[model samples]
Target: MLGFIESVFLVLTITEFILGNLVNGFIVSINGGHWFKSKKISLSDFIITSLALFRIFLLWIIFIDNLIIVFSYHTHDSGIMMQLIDIFWTFTSHFNIWLISCLSVFYCLKIASFSHPSFLWLKWRASRVVVGMLWGALLFSCVCTMSLMNEFKIYSALTRSEDSPNMTEYSRLKRQEYNLMHVLGNLWKIPSLTVSLIAYFLLLLSLGKHRQQMQQYSIGSRDQSTEAHKRAMRIIFSFLLFFLLYFLSFLILASSRFLPETKIARLIGVVITMSYLVGDSLILIFCNNKLKQTFVAMLPCECGYPQPASKGPFAS
Candidate 1:
């Protein structure tokens, strides 16, 4: 029997799962089809496709996790399975964050006007730089996964150990260790978040400099470079907005573990976390020119009216 909040959470999760897959699948199919036909993909499309694919997997993992929680499927014997799921979740989540940071870096290097020799060097080899970042992120995620697995092993061993005469003390110590490990696992996200913030600030600086130059030269406000900078900023800003929300949801979920009575907070966290995928994908679609064009083309028309071509929702 589902309680009211559990029922609502289930409904929201299902809705988000369906919506996320639809949007993310659209991204993959469009980009993948283009790649298949042309045998090449733009670096932006490649990153977008990869991010959408991982997000699809992340959605599935979150959906299953929510189901487990709502249904109380967790049991003593299910520990190993739950741990495996957690590892997969961690890997995908880490990649998602790092890939977003990589995208920010890519946009900054490609669009920003930076005069530094290092910036010029990176801009010339942007593809290689982005690819290297992806590989580095992969290696780092693998290390985190391994660390989590080791922690799980330690926790499992502790769980199986015989109870000491001071049972209460031993139980308290185990609980503390579990909470500590959870916090440490989440702390791994900070480095990627820092990278994203730095990239964002650099882009903002470049935008400001470009605007000042335009003003000094009396250049038109609707020039290509200005539009490019604005578009990139919109995309990055949307990413940051949803990423922060997702982070907040994680905090709420973590707090719910400590305050077991706050079932509503846990449910809300799960809903918000799942919503991030759908929200971010929709933002990408509207912000990216190719994606927005393709999405508009896919819509049905009525009354014998031709659909207007999309130049991106964020276009000036």
Candidate 2:
């Protein structure tokens, strides 16, 4: 007796889960193989590998959470299962977001041009800076993940204590706990979102300026480099846009959590939010020549190569 909400959730979950796993799994496997053979990888490959791994875990947690909500709500609400699910969800999700911000920063460093002294310095030491940022992101995600777990624990306790006989003391404790939870949930996200937006803006500005310069010397058709630049910008913009949408979706889902009647909003929010991982990975494959080539190479082909099309009906 699956209702509309459950049906929709299942459809989106199955489609996104399969697509996300395939794309991310491909990225991870190819990069992993390269790493093994070369004994190292480029910074971009490292970041992609790390991101794909995080995404795979995040998608799994999302699937399990959705399955529990739709099929085993009674079991999920009781005892320690909810807490464990919350922990893994918060950790994997936050880590995925942080890594994406790191990717944005890396792209800015690699692609954008700035005349400021600090920008010049960063550009000079971009590799080291990116490495340090990745480590910092990992550490920060761990701290934030633990903070989320604590906030949830405190919240459960606060709910129970709301039945206490002392009204004033309960009010004070409730206010303190509410504020702590608010800060804990938002502290990491605000900074990461800000950094992501800043990177997006700077990259856009740099590309715009570059495009203007290229236009000055253009005579006929668009050159290969200009087209490439546009393609890169488009890819970045698509990824950033999806990230922003995912952020908003998560916010809606979080706010809707308290409103028991807003089932539709929560369901839609989860579906849209999960789409980001799949969409972002698709963008990476589309934008990067190497990844696109690798994916094409992996596709099954007759005689290990694409065959020319025939005019007949049963052409293979």
Candidate 3:
């Protein structure tokens, strides 16, 4: 039953990934949603959409692993192919966490400039620098994980070595290397996740100060500022929930000595992962009245396009 739910969330997450990308893609430069002469993609736009792209790629890799596990049932006997796939997964997970950390920091600086829009000029240049570094680090981690790809054991009553019956001496040693890399892979997650969360809180505090200054303005301006702030706040919490649940999975694994391991760890992991999709989607669903009303107004025509005029409190 728990696996069934995670499966559903996996589907839902991919759906979000696709739709969000389409939104980021089709969003026109002009406010009226005309395709004739759309706005050019600015650096900020590229950076923001890049974050969604990162999430989509991350989820897709994890989805592959989920499929492999379900189909193979953890037999753990695939050769080089499976080993390489595991390396990809490890690197993707690490890359996703760090990329999102940079994103959180980017948002902090972005929001910090509510008063001085010129401040974002530096971010435009910084985006390229950050993206390059992120790719380099991800590649480095991928190479490191490959070092552990060949390490595995086939323990049996008659088996004398850590190597399997069919595994060669080189394969056996490679397996040892792979095992070591697994520990190192997980070790990186601890710092990556910690950095991501720390950025979240610092960004939140920066936003709080920004909002306070906006409070002195007219109701109309203040209301717009409030809406944007709330949206950012929701995003911060949504990511926090995603990472928090993931961290708890580690604790669940550690508790295996005193508690049943597989059932509880897996069941809870499913719950945590699903909650991210459900909760984050709910934030978008509840907040985006324009998206909802647009569909309603275009019921007999092309549905899901933005309405000609939206009365959403947050609509610009």
Measured by TM-score, how close is model 2 to the native structure?
0.82
Q: Which number leads on lDDT?
A: 1
**Candidate 2 CA-lDDT value:** 0.73
RMSD of each: 3.0, 6.5, 7.4
- Order of quality (TM-score): 1, 2, 3
What are the per-residue Cα lDDT tens digits for candidate 2 across 1-316? 7898689788998899999999999889888998998898878778878889989998898888778777776575445776787678778777777777777777677767779999989989988988998888878888877776666666677667766666668756775865456434744677777777888788778767777876787743364444544554666577668878887777766665455665666667678877988999988775665666677777787234444232110110
For residues 236-271, could you state the per-residue lDDT of candidate 1 as single tens digits? 888888999988887787666577566677678779
Per-residue CA lDDT of model 3 for 47-94, tens digit only, reads 333443454454455445445444553553355555555566556556
Clashes by residue pair, model 2:
none
Please, what is the whole-model Cα lDDT of each candidate in the order they appear? 0.82, 0.73, 0.50
TM-score of each: 0.91, 0.82, 0.57
